[model samples]
Target: MRYVIAVAETGGFTRAAERCHVVQSALSHQIARLEKDLGTRLFDRTSRSVRLTAAGEAFVPVARQAVEAADRARAEVEAATGVVRGRLAVGAISTVAAVDLADVLGRFRAGYPEVRISLRMGMSEELIEGVRQGALDVAFIGLVPGTRPKGVRVRKMAHGELVAVVAPEHPLAGTEQTDLRRLAEESFVDFPTGSAARRQRDAAFEAAGLTAEAPFEITSVESLAKLVRANLGIGMVPEAVAGELRGLHVLRVRNAPTREELLVWNSLGPSPAAAAFLSGLGIDPSERSQRSGRSERSERSA
Candidate 1:
C-alpha cells in the first residue's frame, strides 16, 4: 500500500521508488503482485509517463486511509508507552498573524521531535475544506465577521478591523481617517472578487449603501501592498496585517469591516500530534465540543 501510494502521488515509478527508499524493480514487482491479487490494473505505464488507471484512482484514497489508520494505531500504542510519534499536517492562510507560526512550530518541533510536520498554505475556504476532509489535521483560517465554518471544532484566535491603505503620494495619504463610503470612490486592489477577504471589505461598503470597484485582484497581502504603492489602487486589510506592511499610508476607517482568525480541527477529534500542538497554543482540545456555533463563541471568549 505504501509503494502504491508513493507511485500514485509521485506519478512515476522511478521517483516513487526513490521516495520509498527501494529500487524501481522491487517497487514495480510489489505493485504488480498487488494488482494481480486485486484483479485489476492499477497503473498505465508508458515510456514518458505513468498514470493511474480508473481502478488506481479509486484505490489510492482507500490505500491512504488504510496506511494512515495503521500509522495512527502504532503511534497510539507508542503514546501509551510514553512516546508520542505521528504525522502532523497543518494548513494556514498566508496573511495569518494571530500567532507566530514559526515560533510555535519551532517549539512544537523541540518538544515533539518524533512527530513529522507538514505545512500547507492556502485560502481560508481551501484550508477549511482540507480540515474537513482529514487531509489536514489542523488549520488557521481567517474569515469575515460572523462567518462560521461547519463540520469542524473551532477556537477564535483573534479579531481585528480592516483599514484603508493608500500610496504615500495618493490623495488619501494626507487624511488621518476615512469611511468605507469615501474609499469606495477609488479603484481598489483586493483579494479575488468573491473571497472572504474581499467580501468582508464589500460588506462594509454595502452596509453604508456604497459600491467599490476592484480592478486589480491579488492573492497575497504583499502583492496588494505593491499595487497600492504603485498607485494602481487602494486596499483594505486587517489593521494588524497593515502594520507589518511598509511604505503604505494606513488610514483608520469608520465602520470598518472586521475579521476573525480561527483555529479549526476535525470535529471528530484531533490526532495525538495535533492534540500536542494545540496544547502548546494554550488550548485544551478536550474542551472543544463537536458543536461549533454559540458554544464555540463562549469557549473562545473564555
Candidate 2:
C-alpha cells in the first residue's frame, strides 16, 4: 500500500523506486505482490508512463486517509506520554523574559520535575507565529499595539512600564524623575525601527513632539544594559528588565506607555505540561480576569 501511494505520487515506478531508495525491479516486484494479494490491477502500465487504474484510483483516497490516521494516532500516543514525561517547547523574546520569566519557569520546574523544558528566544513577531504553528507550547511576547493573530490565546502576565535606563552616576540618573522631552535630547540606544519596542517608543516621542538622535542601535537587552552600564548613552527598556541590571538606574518617564507581557499559546488548547506550568504560576486559564479583579479589589481594600 505504501509502495502504491509512493508510485502514484511519483507517477513512475522507476522514480518511486529512486525516491524509496530501492531498485526499480524490487519496487515492481513489491507492487505485483500487492496486486496479487488484493486481486486487482492497481496500475495501468505503459512504455512511457504508469497510470493508476480505476481500482487504484478508488483505493488511493482510502490508503491516504489510513496513513494519515495512523500518523495522527502515533502523535496522540506521544502527546499522551508527554503528560508525565515529555519535552515542552517554549519561546520568548530575549529582553522581556529576562525580567521575570526565570522565577516563573523555576517554580514550574520545581512543580513538574518530570517534564523537560526547552526555551527558544526570538523576536515577538516570530514567537507569536511559532506558538500558532504548534512549534512552541507557549511563548512570552510584548503586546502588539493593534494587530492580533487568529488561533492563539493570550493572557496578560504582567504590566511593564517603559523607563529610561542609565548608569547610576550619569547626570540624568540622579534626577527623581525625567520628562520624555528632556530624555529625548540625549543620544539614545535605540531598538531597530518596526520592532514592538521601537513602535511604542516612537509613539511616545511623537506624542511629546520630540525626536531623538540615536547613533547606536542594539538588538539584545543584555547588550543594551551593558552599554548603559558603561555610561555610553541612555536607552528605554521595560522596568522589570532594567531593574535586573546591577549598575543601571531606571528612571520613569512622565508619559511613556506601559508594555504588557503576555503568555500566548494555540487557541485550540494548551499541552498538559503547559497547562500544569500555568497552574503552578497561579494562572487559571478560564478565570484569569476574575482572579485578577479579585486581587485588585483585595489590594484596594487593604
Candidate 3:
C-alpha cells in the first residue's frame, strides 16, 4: 500500500522509486506483481509519465484506509498479547510475603494463567533500588518518610500498627500494653541500623525520650521473631508479623508508631502483564486515590 500510494502521488515510476528509496526496476516489478494479483491495471503507462486508471483511482483510497486500519489493529493485538503472556518480576520484604503477598500472588496467577510471575524477597531499600534499576517491575516495601527515590512511584498498600513482642515467659509479656520506657529496658532484636523499620523504631524511641539498646542485630524479621521467642530480648515488629509468632506474646504499645506497607515501582510504567497482575491483586491506580483520601481523613481527625 505504501509503495502504491507513493507511485500514485508521485505520478511517475522513477519519482516513486526515489521517494521509496528503492530502485526504479524494483518498484516497477512490485507494482506489476500487485496489478497481476488484483487482475487489473493500476497504472496507465506513457513514455513521459504514469497515471492512475479509473480502477486504480477507485481502489487507492480504499487500499490506503485498509492498510492503515490493519496496521492499527496489529499494534493493538501486540499490546494486548504483551500484557497477557509475559514475565512480571516482583520483589517483597520477607515479612510482607509471609503476611499477605503469597495470597495476593496466588489470586493473580489464577486469573492470569499465562503470565509468569517471579517473586524475590529482600530488604525494603534493596527492593526499592531493584525497581528503580528495572530489575523489578514492582515491590512491596516498608515505607520510609521523605525517602522517595527519583523516577519511582510509591503507593501505600496497607498500614500496620506497631507491637512489642517478647517471649511468653518474659515479665512484660503479661501486660496488655507497655510503655516505651519499660520496653526499652530489655535487650532488643533489631533491624539493621539504617533500615526503614529501624529508622521508625529509633524515631519513636526518640519521641518518647527512650532508647533501644539491642545486644544483637539481625536483618531478617523471621530471625528477629525467633530471637525474641528465645527470650533474647523484646522487639518491636509489625502486628501482622507478630500475630504469626506461635510461642511469643505480642503486647500493644500504648503509643507506638505505625508503618505503611507500600507498593513501589518504576515511573517508566508497567508492562501489560504487570499492570494486569497488579489489577488482579486489587492494587490498581484507584486504590492509591482511596488510600490518599483515608490518610487525609486520618490526618484531619488527628
Query: For all the candidates, what are their Cα RMSDs to the real structure?
Result: 3.8, 10.8, 17.6
**In candidate 1, what are the lDDT values of residues 1-302, reduced to their tens digit?**
99999988898999999999999999999999999999999999999999999999999888987888788789878888988899999998877889999899999999999999999987787888788877899999887765677788888888898888999999999998998768888999998877766777887788889998999998888899999999999998888888988999999998998888899998888888989999999899777633434433321210
Which sequence of candidate numbers ranks them by TM-score, best first? 1, 3, 2
What's the number of clashes in each of the models? 0, 0, 1
Residue range with the least summed lDDT across 10 consecutive positions in model 1: 293-302
- Between prediction 1 and prediction 3, the one with superior lDDT is 1
Instruction: Show the lowest summed lDDT stretch of 10 residues, model 2.
Output: 293-302
Quick one: ranking by lDDT, best first? 1, 3, 2
| Residue pairs in collision within model 1 | none
Among these predictions, the greatest TM-score belongs to: 1
Q: Candidate 2: RMSD over Cα atoms?
A: 10.8
Compose the digit string of candidate 2's lDDT tens values, residues 1-302.
67788999999998898988999999899999989999998999999989999999998878865764464355456657654445567888777643377787787787777678889987677777777666687888775343344457767766756888888889987786898889878988867766765666777788788988777777778877888788888898887776677888888889875676777776766656766766766666454221233222110100
lDDT for every model? 0.86, 0.73, 0.74
Error of 1 at 27 (Å): 1.9
